[model samples]
Target: MRYLYSLLLLCSIVLWSSCRNDFETEPSTGNLQFSRDTVYLDTVFSNIGSSTYNLKVYNRSDDDITIPTIQLAGGESSNYRLNVDGLPGKSFENIDILAKDSIFVFIETTANIENFSNENQFLLTDAIEFDTGANQQKVELVTLIQDAVFLYPEKFDDGTTESLSFGFDEEGNEILIEGFFLDETELTFTNEKPYVIYGYAAVPGNRTLNIEAGARVHFHEASGIIVAQDGSLHVNGMLSNDQETLENEVIFESDRLEPDFSEIPGQWGAIWLTAGSTNNLINYATIKNATVGILTESNDGTSNPTLTINNSKIYNSSNAGLLARTGHVKGNNLVIGSAGQSSLSLSLGGQYNFTNCTFANYWTGSYRSLPTVLVQNYLETPEQIFVSDLIEANFNNCIIYGNENRELVLNERSEADFNARFENCLIRYNDFGFGSQGYDFDDETLFPGTIINVIPNFYNPQENEFMIDEESGANNLANPSTATNQDILGTPRGSSPDSGAYESIIFPEED
Candidate 1:
């Protein structure tokens, strides 16, 4: 009888589970409906500048939404502008006319438009959520604004260092410099000339420069920085009066203005380190005022060169700080300043390492992907920075901080080997903690990846010990030998061990 009763109880439990009525019913949200979950624009223009093709936005749910404030991405806000007045509280608007209710958005800038580049980007935000026109609850919205085809003047030179300065006219035409290489091989420029690059300054042959550390390089008319397969930049540092060597500090700025806020790509390009590029080292440098900062990679990934960046700072560039393709990149002390519009972008699919690095993203206005490993880096619009799905990389002894809206996003399939460890670090942003991993993909996909492997015990900033979060590997990484010897400020952090790119400096205790 006892056995029969037990079997009956088991059967009852199964039957109850199978019945929908046996479980509590979730409250129906029938009134809520979204016009669209997301929207895209082929091109957009602000009072300052324009954007390139591929702009996108995210709708938090299936509900109506509105945008409150908007700004251009990168530093090109002087040419074009965005018109946000006609946009309904729940309706969206752009310069282009797209088929209503469709996900596809297409817009382009005119040739008459000014201050627009091929790399211009824009970001839009909506603070509060509201209901659709109906009785439904409103959904949140996030959008990327940009335009298609930010064109630049097509004039380039491949010769020895000369007094070359190029720029754009008031009508936005290319201004070329016709001169021979100077005897000193030093290209000096005056602010009177405003040159822009339609493409990039491609150094094909071997090149060397002895530039002043604080020299300003205004890339007003260059698409980006491309070191050809055979190119080489042996930027030797300068020795300061206090024994500080000359740091190669290159500032990238543009002529784009505000109102339309029109600046895009092809206005200023990225710095590409190609194959056969030898010993490209930069120290005590600051790379800012352009589209993308310093990048080391080949589009096909066959090039495997080495570059070292020590005691450097990269800030205010349009997108990432330091982007490494399939190569070897090492830095002793590096600081990456963030614009808060975008996080410090890193595509580490190669052998990359850092001794002491600091990444700061204090701005919390828009939502951006924090630096970590991720898959599917696709930015169809101005605000998005795409992650090239197939790459291997790591970040060590680094300090990563951001605001509440931003976060570090690591996809499920990406695997970062041991060299990708974040030892003695502090990462705090948004509603998330420093180190945690989640199951983002399932077995159905070819790649199953995770976001991070953090060692929580090591994250104690007060104790100055940091450990990468792992299922069980925290103990091994916490060894004292792994502590970074220096800080971003170029000071000794002490052997006692601190986390990330900073060390704790404790004075001697008084007796």
Candidate 2:
């Protein structure tokens, strides 16, 4: 058949010349071996975008090279941004790299700082380079940026978009909200720089906001801080008098400055306070991760306490670290910790008063079905059935522990009014199930001088560290004049007081 078609065209030309001699055009004499000549990319926040940073590039010699130029020394007017191996670049060519193989690059940044004018942080640099065959390499990158106070949400022209306004709707009608109201000169927030929000920032009814004291805010992703109704939000974080320094506190988190997002729980939203917002304070401050760290709502029976936390610390909340629907809150040296549901939820009920607080919840990030203080009153939807009136839910010298086994929960609801109280507290709850509709740590008149299922040696409930171990059983049980004679780091508290917000201070074991 014509000599088998010339032996199938000479075996397809010897398999395309043995696949072009198994690739390897040589041409690189640079000896490239980087995995980090200078990546840094840390602080970010002027125009935001960051967090990719990689590098690799090894090819430890065995031939196959070719890199003639990979560069971005500010190439396309760079503000940093590259990709390289998967191409998306500021410049690249030849590339290839086989024999001892390795090649990644990544890097990212956003930085705009309105042409940066020398102030609240601003470094940003760049380099990359590489060119081969005649040698030339480099890497460096750096970052820093900062310059915040962003806030967002405002897009009128009929396309509608202002944000932050859940105002009226319990039959008082008038509801049509959706944010945007600040004005009182943007409401305060000072401590020199970092703010960043990006959506719900409301506060308008009678306006208040404040913030100051080393402020740092952040937010983003589902942002927060509402307030409205009669509005007010204070925050003042103050301590410095040898309290070993939380500098000046005030740090609401999550704009993700990445360390794998620190303790990453809900990453933002909540700090609401709504229902006719009243006094609202929040001293020393810390409020972390979010999605409910201070919700509030319900108050209208005002007696001057609609919120008044002090020496604050709400931690990684994925739901409630102090929610209080029928609100009236009033903490003191508080501490709240990890919570995928309740670390103090007092739902649909009002008037709560913690003191030397510390509600701990060893939530290892997932599967935490409630409890760490819940006390409810009523809430059945399907179109109406609300009920509220928890009239007074106290908890002096508190320490309600958690890691479940019933860490306190009382959902009452036979037509409202659940009135609570648990003095000299330390309850880790073992459900002493009392009649008339639940709750009874052996009812010593509703848990007076309460201690129940004890074990508050804390000092590190898996690191949320609710400081207390001096062979704690909440040592000296508290009530030295209703606790708080210092603690929350200001130390003192001695004539027999140590219960929760820290006051065990011994130190001295460091051979």
Instruction: Tell how far residue 398 is off in model 2, in angstroms.
Output: 26
Model 2, 1-511: lDDT tens digits are 9999999999999988888767757978888899888989888788889889889999898888988889888899889989899988789999988879889989898977779666888898989889944598898898888898887778899998875434588788656544567787889999888898876788887779999887889888788888878888999988856444466888898887867787887888888887898888889988888888888888756687888888888888888887877888888889999889888888777888888888989988889888888888877689987988898898897888888778887888779789888888887766545542445565777777777677877756766777876777888888998888888878788899877898875544667
What TM-scores do the predictions have? 0.44, 0.36
The segments of candidate 1 whose C-alpha lies over 4 angstroms from its true place after superposition are 1-199, 208-212, 221-224, 238-267, 299-305, 339-342, 364-392, 412-419, 429-485, 500-511
Clashes of each: 92, 6
Which structure among the candidates has the greatest TM-score? Answer: 1
Candidate 2 off by > 4 Å: 1-25, 28-49, 55-68, 73-77, 81-98, 103-106, 113-183, 187-253, 257-263, 266-288, 295-320, 323-343, 347-363, 366-373, 376-511
Q: Count backbone clashes in candidate 2.
A: 6
Cα lDDT tens digits, model 1, 1-511, are: 9999999999998988788543232222223234454333223233323342222333434333333223332113222223233332223422222222213222223222233344435454332222223323432323344332222333347643222344687689766442222223333222222224344555544553333454444455545545545455543333233423233343344444322333232335566676555556676655654556777763423343367777666655555666654456676657665542343444434555665565554433244445422222332346654433434344554555543333455442233332234444444424345565533222223211212233233333222222222332222222246545555445565544444444443333468
What TM-score does candidate 2 reach? 0.36
Q: In lDDT terms, how accurate is model 2?
A: 0.82
